[model samples]
Target: MADSAPEVPAEERQEDPDVVDRKAEVLAEQIKKSKHFIVFTGAGISTSAGIPDFRGTEGVWTLMAQGRQRPSAVNTLQAVPTATHMALVELQNRGILKYLVSQNCDALHRKSGILPDRISELHGNNNREYYFRAVASYEKTVHDHRTGRKCVRCGGDLLDSIVNFGEYLPAEPLRLARNHAKKTDLCLVLGSSLTVPPASGIPETVGTRKAAKLVICNLQETPLDGLVDQRIYSKADELMTRVMAKLDIPIPQFILRRRLIVQMETTGGSRHQLKICGVDVDGTPMTFLRSIKLDQYCRRAACIEPFTISFRSDLDIGTELKLELEFMGNYGEPNLEIIYSYTGEAGTEMMYLLEYNPQTGEWKTERQESQSVDEDKKPTRRGR
Candidate 1:
C-alpha cells in the first residue's frame, strides 16, 4: 500500500557528531523554556528496532517500488522500543512533553509506558482492534483487518485498527493532534519525512504560528525542512539520546508488564470453572498468553480466548491448583506458573501483575485480590 504513494528519492544524510550535540543543546534549552512542548514521530524512529521505514533507501516502500523483495524483518510484536521511544516516555514522565502525535502503527509509544491519554496515533495501531464503539488489543497476526472476534457487549465484529491506503485517518486522534499542534510553543518532529497529509499538515500548522518554534530531525529531506527553525539530519535515537542527556533525564529501559485476571466461578456442587486471560491497563482483553495448562491434571486449554477449564474436583478449600502459562514469547519470556488455592467461593477473582525484563532475563509476579463492584452503579470520574 505504501507503494501507491508518489516515490520520493531515498537519499539519507547524517550530520557530524559535534553538530548534533550542539543542536541537541539548543533543543534542550528550547524544551526548558517552552510552556507547551509536543512531539510528532514517523516510521524512522522505529527502524532501529528492526522495523523498516517506508521512505528510507532500503525501506519497504522503496524496495516495493523498485520491484525488489521486501526486506525480511522482525514482526511488530517482537520489535522492542528504541532509545527514542524510551526518551519520549521519560520526557512525558518529567512533565516536559505535553503530548505526542505518531503516524506509526507499531504501538511502540504505548509499549514504552506512555499513557494512552497522552498520545494520539493518527494512523491507528497495528496491535489494536476496534469494534463499533470499543477498542481492544489484537496480539495475533491480523489479516484483512478482521480479528475474528466480536464485541462482548454488542456482538459486533472487531476490525484491526490499521489505516490502509485511501482510508480516512481516525477522527479523534487527528483532532487531538491538531489541537496540540495549535497550542504547542515548541514542536519537535522526529523521523518523519512529512510527505503524508493531512497528518503531514499538522506540523505545518505549528510552523505557521508566529511565536512557535518547529524543529525537524530526520536523515531525509522533508518538505518542512525550509520552514523549521532548526534541522538536524540524524537518527531519532541518536538525537534523542543526546537531548535527554542534556536535559539531565535518563532514558528508562523497556519492561514487558502485563496484567492477568484469573477468576473462578462455581457452577454448582464441587464443579468450578477457572478462567485466565491477559488484559491491558484499561481492562481490555490482551492476547499475550498462547496456551494455559493445568498441572497434575494434565489438562490444557489451547483455544483462542476465554481460556477456561472445567472439572469436578472434590479437593477441599486451601488446596493449591497450579496453572502453567505459556506466553507468546515475543521477548523470550519463558513459561510461567500460577498457584492458586481453591477458595470454593462463588465469583472469586484475582489479579496478577507479571513483569519481565529482557535485558536482565528476570521475571517477577505479584498477586492481588480483585475487588468486585456493581456494574449497574454509575461510576465516578477521576482526574488524571
Candidate 2:
C-alpha cells in the first residue's frame, strides 16, 4: 500500500505555486456580477462618527497602552453618528453587505444599528467583560460567570473581551474574518488608517488569496492607499450619505453658504485728491459725487458752504495778514463766520472761520460751523 499520507519532500515545497489564481479573477468577476460583499472598517472611519479610534502614537489604542484609560462608552453613544456609520448601516439594510468586521471596542458599530450577527466584533466590546478561551473557535465567558458558581470552562481569571496590546487576537472572530476574506467578492474598507497588524494584513491577505476587489476609503493618506482598487478621500458621514443615495435610500439634504461686507472713511490734505483706494465690501467705490474748490477768500461774510472749503494760495492755517484798518470809532476786530453743509449717509459736517492776526502772527478760529435739521442760511454779519 502507498504510504497512507504521501508526504511531499521539503525541497519540493520550496517551489512557488502559481501566484496567479483563477479565484482572484473569479472573485473580481463575481464582484461585478453579484451584490454580496464583506466590509472591514478601521479606526479612521469612527473618527468621523465622533468616536476616537486608536493604534498610532496619537491613537486611542496607543494612549490606552501607555496606561491611559479610554473614555466611557456612554459619551460615544450620546454623540451623533457620522456619515460613515450611516453608510454602513445602509449597506447592511440593503442586503449588499455579507458582514462587517471592526477592531473598535467602543461598540459604536452596534449602536449604529448593524445587526450583531452580521458584524464580527473582532476586538470585542468594552462595556461588557469576558475572557478569551478555546482553540478553533475562541469562546467568551461572561465576566459575571455566575453568582451561583465560578468560571467552569478554564477556572482561569475572566477578563474583558477587548483585546489589548500584547494580547493575541481572539481566534474565532479572526478565523471568520479570514474565511470572509477568502470568499468575499467585494471588500469595502472605510475610515481605517490601516496601520496596525493582523487587521491591516486583511487587505493584503484578501489580495493574495485571490479573494476580492478591495476598496479603501479614508481621509488622510495611508500605506494601503495606492494598493487598493478604489480610494475615496472624505468624511465618513458624507461618503455614506452618497452611498445610501446610490442604493435608493432616502437621506436628508443639507448644504452651507456665506456672504460678507465692509465700509471705511479717511481725511484728505492739500495737493492730494481724495481718492477711495481700498477694497470695498463688494470691491467697488462707494457711490457719491465729490466736489473741490480752491483759492477762495472768506473774510467778507459767511461765504462757505458744506461740501465746500476755501484756502489761501500763499498762506496755510497760520500766516500773518498785515492790514492797516483805521476805525472811525472805538470797536474791536471784526468776527468772521464760515458755513458748510453735507447731505449723505451718517450725517457728519463742520465748518470753521479763522483769522490771522498780523500783531501776534497767529491763526485763531473765530467761529465754528454747526449742523441744523433744515437747510442753513447765509449769516447776515460782515467780517474783520
RMSD of each: 4.4, 30.9
Top candidate when judged by lDDT against the true structure: 1
For all predicted structures, in order, the TM-scores are 0.89, 0.46
Worst 10-residue lDDT window for candidate 1 reads: 375-384
| lDDT of model 1, residue 235 | 97
- The per-candidate count of clashes, in order, stands at 0, 13
How does each model score on lDDT? 0.83, 0.47
lDDT of 2 by residue, 92-189 (tens): 77676788888776755664566656877776665333333322233443323222211222233434456655567877778888878778767877
